[model samples]
Target chain A: MKKQIITEGKIYFPLSETLKLVIENIMKRLTRALLTMSGIVLSIAFYTTLMLTASALKYTLGAQQVISEYYWWMLFLAFLVSATGITNSVLMAVAERVREIGTLKCLGAMDKHILEMFILENAFIGAIGGVVGFIVGIIAAIVLNASTIGISSFFAIPGIEFLKALLSSILISTVLSVVMSSYPAYRAAKLQPAEALRSVA
Target chain B: MGGEASYAYTVEVEGLKKYYKMGNTIVKALDGINMKIYRGEYLSIMGPSGSGKTTLFNMIGGLDRPTAGKVFIDEVDIAQLDAYELAWLRARKIGYIFQTFNLIPVMTAYENVVLPMIFAGVEAEERRRRALELLDRVGLLKFKDHKPYELSGGQQQRVAIARALANNPAIVLADEPTGNLDLETGMEIIKLLKELNEEREVTIITATHDIKMLAVSDRIAWLRDGKIQRIEKRSEVRFKVYKVEG
Candidate 1:
C-alpha cells in the first residue's frame, strides 16, 4: 500500500528529484564558467608563452617583473588560494545555468532554493576547480619562480605556506568573481518564467 | 456571488476584473466575469484574439490575481491568500500546462514531471517513485532520461501532461496545449487528455482557438471580446443541432 503523500496540505516529491535538477543545473553553470574563463585562460597561456621566449631570459629583474605585474602569475595563484578558481568558475557556472534559473522559478522554487542552487552549484564547481586550479597554478608559479628565465637568479621555493598563500590568493579572486556574478544569477531568477522560457537565441 | 447551481463547483469566480494600463488606455482584460467549473468534467474555453481567454486562464491557475474579484478553489478564497499561500495553492492544487509545452528544457523527462512536488517540499524517494510511475503511465518510461529538446512535440506534450499531474491535483489548466503540435499529434494529445478524464475523473480546462478542442470538450464557455457569449454543454450542442435539422 502506498503511504499517503500529502499530510496537512503539503505535497512532497523525492528530495533527490530537486537535487538532481539542481545538480544538473550546476553542471551547466560549470560548463559555462569554463567557457567564460577560456579567454582569461588563453590570455594566461599566451602571456606565459611570451614570457618563455622574452628578451628578459637570464635577468633577475625581468623574471621578478614577471612575478610582479607583467605576468603576476601569482595573481591567479593568489585568487585560487582562499578558494581559487571559485570566483571565475562560479561566475561562468551561474551564467551557464541561465535557463535552469528561470525554469526553477517557474517550478515555484522559492528565493532560497534559487539562491542556494546557484551558490551551491558554483561553489561546488569552484571547490573542484579551486583544488585543481590551485595545484596547477602553484606548479606553474614554482616552475616560473625556480626555472632559469631570460635571466638567472638565486631562486628559493618555500616548501609550505608559499603553497598556502598561492592557493589563498586564487581563492580570493574566485570568491570575488562568484560574489560579483551572483546578481546576474538573481536577475535570471527574477525573470518571469513566461518571458524566460522564450527562445534565448 | 453568482447564482448557486444544484452541484458544488470545483472552481468558482465572481466579479473578476483585471486590467493593465497600457499608456493611456486601460485594457480591461477580464471585466466582471463570473464563472464556475464543475468536477469530473473536460471543458474548453475558446475566444478570438484579444478576448482575454488566456488572462482568465492565468487568473484561474493562480499565476496572477484578479484585481477586483475572488477566485475560490475547493472553497478557499484565493484572493485573500498571501503570496506564500498563493504559491502553496499553485504548488498543491493547480496543474498548469502551457501552449508551448513549457517543460524545463534543462531537466530530463523524469525530473521535469516531479518539479511541482519538489516545490511543495516532498521527500526524495517518494518523488522519484511517483515521477517514474507517472512517466511509465504516460508510456515514456524508456524516454525518462531524455531532455525537452530531445523529444518530439507530441512527446513533450505528454511530458507536460505528466508534469501537470505531478501534484495529483484535481484540476488541470491547459492553455492551448496543442497549438504548437501538428494535426495528427494534436489529435493524439486530445485522446490522451480524454483518457485521463475518463480514468481519473480529473477536471481538464483547456483554452484554445481551435475548433477541434470544442469537439472533445464536455462543455465549452465561448468567449467574445472578454465576455462569455455562451456556455454550452455537449448534450446541449447535440440537442441544438438536432432541433436546427428537425
Candidate 2:
C-alpha cells in the first residue's frame, strides 16, 4: 500500500533519504565538486579582499568624502564575474550527469525532487565556499593593509563591524550561488528521462 | 481495489502510437498497437533493433508518453495522469531493469536497491530490511557494500534486479536484461526472473533479442515494423539449435 504525508500543501521526502542521496552524489565526485567550488571561493575572496583594502585606504588616506559611483560599479563587476563562474560550473555539472538524472527519474523521482537535489547540492557548495572565502579574505585584508593601518591597528577594528562584514560576505556569496545555479537546476529538472538516457548513449 | 474498475490484466495498451520527427520525415516508432499483459504471467517481447520493442516497454512503464493511445495499468489510464501521478504510478506499480545495469556508480549495491524505496517514502527501518532481503533473494547479499564498478557485470545486473523489486511493484519491466551478460550469466539472470514470476507472481515483461529468454517466458510476442507479428505460447514455440563455424 502507498503511504503519503503532506505538510504545508507540499509533498515531502524523508529527511534521511534526501541527505543520504545528496551526500552520496557529492562524495562520489569529490574532486570535481571541489574544483567547481573553487571558482566561487576564488571569486568571493577577490571581491572581499578588494572591499577590505578600499576601506583601509579610505581611513589611511583621509578620503571619507571621496565615496563615489565608481566604487559601486567595481563592486557590481566583481559580483557579475562571480555569478558567471557559478553558472558555468553548475551547467557543466548538469551536462555531465544527464544519465544520472535519467536514472533517478526512472526510479520515480519527480522534477521537483530533482530540482531540490541540485539546489541543495549547490547550496552546500556555496556555504562551504563562502566561509572559506571569508576566512581567506580576512587574512589577505590584514596582510595588504598592514603598512597603512599597522598590524595592531588592523586588529583593532570594531567587533561589530567585523562581524557585520563577515556575515554580509557569506550571505552575498550564498545568495549569488543559489541565483546563478537556478537556471541550470531548472534545466536539469525539465529533462525527459527517456531523452536523457538516449542523449548519453 | 473495491472502488476501482478492475481488469484481469496488469497492463493494457490500446492504439499506441509514437512518432518522431526527423528532419522532413516522421519515424513511426510504435504504430497503432494493442496488447495486454496478464497478472502473474511472464511475457517476453522479441523484435529486431528497429521494431519498437523498447518503445512499447517505455509506454507500459510510464517512462514515455504515447502520441495517440491509452495505457491502463491495473485499469487506471496512465496517459490521463499528470507528471506527479505518473511518478506515483511508477513508484508503486512499475519497476524497471535496464540492459546496461544502470546502478548509480557511487552508491553501494545496498544503496542502489534502497533507492526506489526512498522515492516511495518507505520508512527507513522497513526500507533497509526489505533492501537486504531483496539482495539476498537475488543472491547478491554478500556484495551489498560493493559499488557497481567493483562487481562483475552479472553481479551488477543482480543488484539492478534487486533494485527493481525494492518497491514491491506489481510489474517489472526489463529491457534487454541479459543483453550485456555472458551466456552462463545470462541464463542465470533469466532463471532468477522466472523464479520471481512463479514464486512472487510478479508480472514480468521483457523486451529482448535473446532466444533463451523466449524459452523461459510463458508467452512470447514478436514485433516487426512497429507492430506485433505473432504471439506464441511457450509449448508452441519450437526452438531449434544450430551450430555455426567460423
Candidate 3:
C-alpha cells in the first residue's frame, strides 16, 4: 500500500458544539458546579448590595458621602478571596479529569481547544453566578434600607445606576473567573498525554 | 530481499530508547529497540509489567517522545513533525483503545464516537451518520444514549472500540485492552478486534498479557527487560495446557 503524503489537516469544533459540551458538563456535575459558583455569587452579592445601598442612601438623604473607605477595602478583600476560590476549584476539577484530558489529546484535541473549553465553562458559571447574586443583592438592599430610607425611596433609586451596578458586577465576576482559571487551564493543556494517562485520576 | 518492496510496513522503529531519571539513577525503560509492523497485520506485544510494552506502544502512537532514535509512521519520521502535524497524524492515522476505556464520562456512547470526527472537522450530518454506523458495527447502537458509567465493562469497551474506528484510521493501537474484563468478556473483545481487523484491513497492534490473543495475532513480539526477545509467527508458536493435581 502506498502511503498518502502529509498535508495540513483542519480541526473544526464549532463554537456551538463547544458551548453544548460545556453546558452538558456543568449540568452533569451540577453539585460541584454550584459549589464552585458559591464563592463568586456571595462576593458579587455583597458587592452589589453595598453599592446599591450606598446609592439609595445618597439619593434619599442627599448625603455628601455614602460608602466608606473601609467598605471599599472589604469589597476588594472579598473579590480576592473569591478569585482564589475560583482558582482552587478549577485546579481541582482539572486534576480530577486528567485521564479525560489525556483521552481528548489522543483524539486530536489541541492545547488551545482544552484551554478554550475550561475558560468557557468557568465563564458561563461566573455569568450565572453574577446574575443570581445581583437579584439577591437587590432584594437584600431593599429590605435592609426600608426602615431608614422607606419603601418609597427604594423606588426612587435611579434605574440607570442600578443597571450600571448590575452590569459591572457581571463583568467583574466573569473577568475574575477567566483570570483565575487561566493558570489551571494552562496546566491542563500542558499535561503530557502519556503521564496523564498513567495517572489514576 | 528481492521482494522487500512487496511488503508494506505501516510503522518502523529504529534504535528506540526511553530513559527516566529517578533520583540520581537512570531507568532505561526502553533500550535500543527496533521493529517493523506491516500494514493490515494483527500484532501483539506480550510482556510482564515494567517490560516497556506500554512504553513502546506510546512511542508508536506518538503519545510520547523517545529519548533517542526515530519512529516512522507510513514512511514519515514522526520526530520531524511539529506539534500541530503530530496531532494531525494522530487524528487521521492512529486510533487508540485503553485498558480503562477512557471515554469522556460526560458524553453518551454516541457522542463519544462522534468526538474524534468533530475534531477532524467532519460535518455534523456525516458525524451523526458515521457515529451511528460505527456504534451499530460494535453492536452498541441500542445503547447509543447511555453514558460510560451506565454501561457494563464489556459494553463500555465495545463503545470505546466504536470510538476508535470513528475516523477510519489506518492503525489501531490497543494498550491492554482486555486487562480489566472477565475471561469470557475478554475473549469476546479479542474476537471482536480480530473480526474488525479482518473486515477493515486496519493494522491492529495490542500490548497485553492475554494468551487468548495469540490465537488471533498474526505475529507476536515477546518483550523482556526493555528489549524484544523474539518475534514469532502464529504458526511457529505453541502452548502447553497443564492441569493442577490436588
Candidate 4:
C-alpha cells in the first residue's frame, strides 16, 4: 500500500521551498521589521548624517582633510549596517525555527539540506531587502541633493557615477549579508532534529 | 542481515535512554526503553503527563541523541548516524505530525505542504505537482492559496498531516495530534489517520491521551512516569488492528 524506500536520489533538493518559506518569514517580518531593521536604519542615518556634516564643512571651511574624504567611506558604513540587519534577521529566524527545524530533521532532512535552506533563504532576504533598501537609499540621497542644490541636481540621476554607486551598494549588501549570516546558517544546519523538536520557547 | 531481502522492522527502538538537565537536576525522560513497530502498524502510545512518549519519538526521529541505547529504522540504527547523516535520513525516512499543526502563519497551504519536498530538492514541476497532490490528498487543494490564519484547527492539522507525508517517509510519528481539537474534529483526524495507515501502509505511531485512538490501535503502549507500564494488544498483534465505527 506504500511506496518503497529507496533514497539514493535527492530528498531535500529544490532550494526554492526554503527560499519560499524565508520570503514568507520576511513578509511576516513587517510588524517587527522596524525593530529587526533598527541596526540598518541607524547605520544608514549615521552615514548620511556624517556625509551631511562633511559636506557642510567642505562648503564652509574648504579644508584639505574634508576634500580627501571619499563618498565610498560613507557607503561602506551604510553597507555594514545593512549587512548586520540581514544577518540579525536571518539568525533570529533560525532561532525561531527550532521546532520546524526539528520536524525537518525528523522527516529525514540532511543537515546540509537544512543549512542550505537557511542560507538560501537569508541570501534571498538580503537580495530583496538590500535591493529595495539600496533603491530607497539612492532616492533619499537624490532628494536631499535636489533640495540642497536646486533642480540642476536632478541631472545626477543618469550619471555613470550614480549607476556605479548603485551597483557597488548592491554588491556590498550581498557580500555583507552572505558573510555575516554564514555562522548562524551553519548552526541551523548542525541542529539535531530530535533534540531540536524538544526545545521550548 | 547483509544482502537480505527484508527489513527487520519499520522501527526498532532498543533500550533507549535520554536525560535532560532542569537547571541542576537531571530528569530522566526515557530510561532504557525498547520497542519494535512493524510495517503498517496502527499503534497508539498512551501516557499521563511527564511520560516519555515525546522523548522516545525524538530519539527515533534522530532529533536527540540518547544517553544510552540504539534506534533502528528500516534496519538502520538512527542513534549511530552523525548529524549530517541523521539529517539526511530524517528528511527521507520519517513523517512527523505534531499536535500543534505548526504551519507558518504567513505561508499558503500549498507552501506548507511543499516544505518537505522542497527541502528534498525535487524539481520545480515535480514539486508543484507533489504539493498540489498532497494538498488535494488532505482535501485542501482548494485552500492552497490561503494562509494558516484562514483555516480552522482541524484544517490546519490536516495540512500538517499533508506536510508530514510530503516526503512519504516510512513511519509517521504523531504527538498528541488531536490534543487541541474538539471531539468531532478529533474523531475526524483519527479517521483520516486510519485511512492513511490503511491506504499507504505508512506505519503510524500516535502518542496521545485519546482513548479512541487506544481503543482502535493494533497495540497501545500505556506509559506512566517515563516508563511503559503496560502494552496491550487490541486485536491482531502489531497492526492487524481493531475495527471501530467511522
| Highest TM-score against the true fold, candidate | 3
Q: Which candidate number has the best lDDT?
A: 3
Residue-by-residue lDDT tens digits, candidate 4, B43-162? 888876678888876677666678988887777666556655555566666777887777766778888787677656667788789889888987988999998899999999999999
> Pick by DockQ: which candidate is best?
3
Q: Write the per-residue lDDT of candidate 3 for residues B1-246, one digit (tens) a residue.
A: 122335599899999999999999999999989999999999999988888989999999999999998999878789887777777777778999999999999999999999999988888899999999999988989999999999999999999999999888889999999999999999999999999999999999999878888999999998888899899999997665552110
TM-score of each: 0.76, 0.91, 0.95, 0.80
Per-residue CA lDDT of model 1 for A42-130, tens digit only, reads: 33333333333332332434444333464465545533443334344454444554545544554566555665555555544444454
Q: Tell me each candidate's i-RMS in Å.
A: 7.6, 5.9, 5.3, 5.2
Candidate number that wins on DockQ, 2 or 4: 2
Which stretch of 10 consecutive residues in model 3 chain B shows the poorest summed lDDT?
B237-246
Q: Which candidate order results from sorting by TM-score in descending order?
A: 3, 2, 4, 1
**Lowest lDDT block of 10, candidate 2 chain B:** B237-246
| Deviation (Å) of A135 in candidate 1 | 4.7
- Each model's DockQ? 0.23, 0.39, 0.52, 0.38
Candidate 4 lDDT over residue span A4-56, tens digit each: 23455555455545566566666776644444444544444444434443444
Residue B25 of model 4, lDDT score: 96
